[model samples]
Target: MRLLLKNTKLLQTKEQLQTCDVLIENNRIIAIKTDVESTTADQIIDCRGNLLVPGFIDVHVHLREPGGEHKETIETGTKAAARGGFTTICAMPNTNPVPDSIDRVENLHEKITADAKVRVLPYASITTGLQGETLSPITELAKQNVFAFTDDGVGIQTADQMLSAMRLAAKAGKAIVAHCEDNSLLHGGVVHQGLASERLNLPGISSVTEAVQIARDVLLAEAANCRYHVCHVSTKESVRVIRDAKRAGIKVTAEVTPHHLLLNEEDIKDADANFKMNPPLRSEADQEALLEGLLDGTIDMIATDHAPHATEEKALGFLKAPFGIVGLETAFPLLYTNLVKTKKVSLRQLIDWLTIKPAEAFQLPYGTMEIGKLADLTLIDLNSSEKIDKQKFYSKGKNTPFEGWKVFGIPKLTVMEGKIVYNNL
Candidate 1:
């Protein structure tokens, strides 16, 4: 399968844009030039002056396949991801049975191959069954193609337990992704511990609940000499911790979500469950710090943290309801519309964060438009404008807070390995 994309503006790096024709043969990019005639391909796309980018890669996503299919499936979730311009998504291990063992990891691979339209990478659980007491088959799971290990829904509460796991992961050369929550400190709170919680008369999750874990995990990773990652970073204090860790030469990388960057406690009102999530959104000061963190390169990448819950589950008020929202379908538009189109960040810089930085962090070779690379690609319609329609979501979950967000710049087409997987047309 050979294909030619014409008049494409490709983002080569944070500060570079290379406009050319990207010729792909089978699954790898073969040529990038000014004028490639249509005779050398099976198909030729005009591109129509759209940006041709390496497909977006999200390091954090929840597919909910094994048991929570009522909320999401690899099939439905990846469809949403492809639509959001993502080519590869690293799935969380907090499934029903959990991908803790090698067999479970292998099962996820098989399921992804059979059901997913986009690439579905797995994260083996850091603790077996996520009980936080016993370690899963870390080395064996890593050998079986797990992108990283994470007990994402919760952290290993015991310092000793986490240290032991870190040692093993370090020895095995695996990336250990921390959910960074202090469970002992959590009293089943549903909002950030701040003025909002005080006003609403609700229990809240303290910023320290996430920050303390990050402080400890950074030192632990430094001690163990391992690649450590913090997921869904939401607080300014936490960002400061991560920045200090990076400056001191620890293998620490972190991700901030679009919602966290754009919305905060001020945006939540009247007990809306859509605004509720674990490590609940913080204040304006914290949100400003997050934007600063992203702009100055203190944060490594952007991820969706695309957790989805069923409607019945989310209807139980704010405190009793599950914490999450649908993210895959809305991430790109929200990020591009808010960050790039508004000039908060350069377009090239946004592309680099969405692709190259994630590729560099996970050691995945899928985020470049260079020749001989895999042809995972996203074509954007920079001028398209529409309101978000949650009623027609591909995933079973409609738990988004961004419903009717009048945003523009959506992925008009997404192609993986030279095959058109999603086309808005």
Candidate 2:
């Protein structure tokens, strides 16, 4: 089959936007030029000056399947990713079965093969059952094609345990993705250890909890020569550690979530659960450092740590509620409207963070608009504006903090392997 995307705008560079037509045959882009009107087969889409770019990629997301199905599933999560212009997403391994063994990894793969609407790369837990007491079968699970090993949702407690995992992962040629948190320093905190926590009279989560762990792990990673990745980085101290590590030639990469980039502790005016998240919204100084990291290449990519919980669970309020919010359906619009439109970040750089940078960090094959590349694409109407309505989301989780916020850059269509997965055109 052949598919034609006519009159779409492509960002060829930071300052250059080109108008062109793209032609795809089967699952590969066959031609891209001024006109592909003469080439015809299955169908054609008139993009009408919309932006056609490589599909977005999210390196960090929680699908909550095989264990937390009531919150989300492979089918529903990928559908939400499609609507958000993501053609690929990596699933965190904080599920019921944990996917620590080859058998368990195979079981998760079966679910993805049968139910996923977009590419779903699953991670195997770094430690057995994510207990942090012992390492999982890292070498064996790596051979099974797990994307990476992570003990997400909780940090590996000891430096010895993390070093051992990193050594095994380095030998296995796999990345060791970490959730940096020091339980000893948490102090039973629920929100950031700042003015918000003081004003709300809630226990505070200190920035030291995250930064101290990262500082230790980077040294361990350097010693073990492992590809280490940090998840949902939110603090200036954490950014300083990561930046210093990168400067010192440590093999490290990190991701900052959209929530961290756009929102801060000051936004938490009340006890609303929607604003709650792990590595909670921090001070404005921290937010500024995160942006600086992204701009200077210290931060590698932008990922939506898209965690979803039941509405009733979140209704418990910030103190007792879960630490997460749904992000897959709102990342693009929120960033584009708040950052790009506000001139804080250029459109080209934003696209790179969402698409190519994540792919490069993880070594994925998607996220480029070139002839002969796989036809995974997204068409977005940059001129259109709409209010973010949680009720209209395809995700089973509607716990976004951006609810009712006006935004632009709505995705009109998402195509994976030359097949339409989402269409609002």
lDDT of each: 0.88, 0.93
Instruction: Please give, for residues 1-425, the per-residue lDDT of candidate 2 as tens digits.
Output: 89898889988765577899999999999999988765475798888999998999999999999899999999999999999999999999999999999899999999999999999999999999889887898999999989999999999999999999999999999999999999999988999999999999999999999999999999999999999999999999999999999999999999999999999999998999999999899999999999999999999999999998889899999878989999999999999999999999999999999999989888899999899999999999899899999999888898988889999999999999999999999
* Predicted structure 2, TM vs. truth: 0.99
Lowest summed lDDT over 10 consecutive residues: which window, candidate 2? 34-43
Cand. 2 Cα-lDDT: 0.93
List ranges where model 1 is wrong by over 4 Å: 12-19
Clashing pairs in 2: none
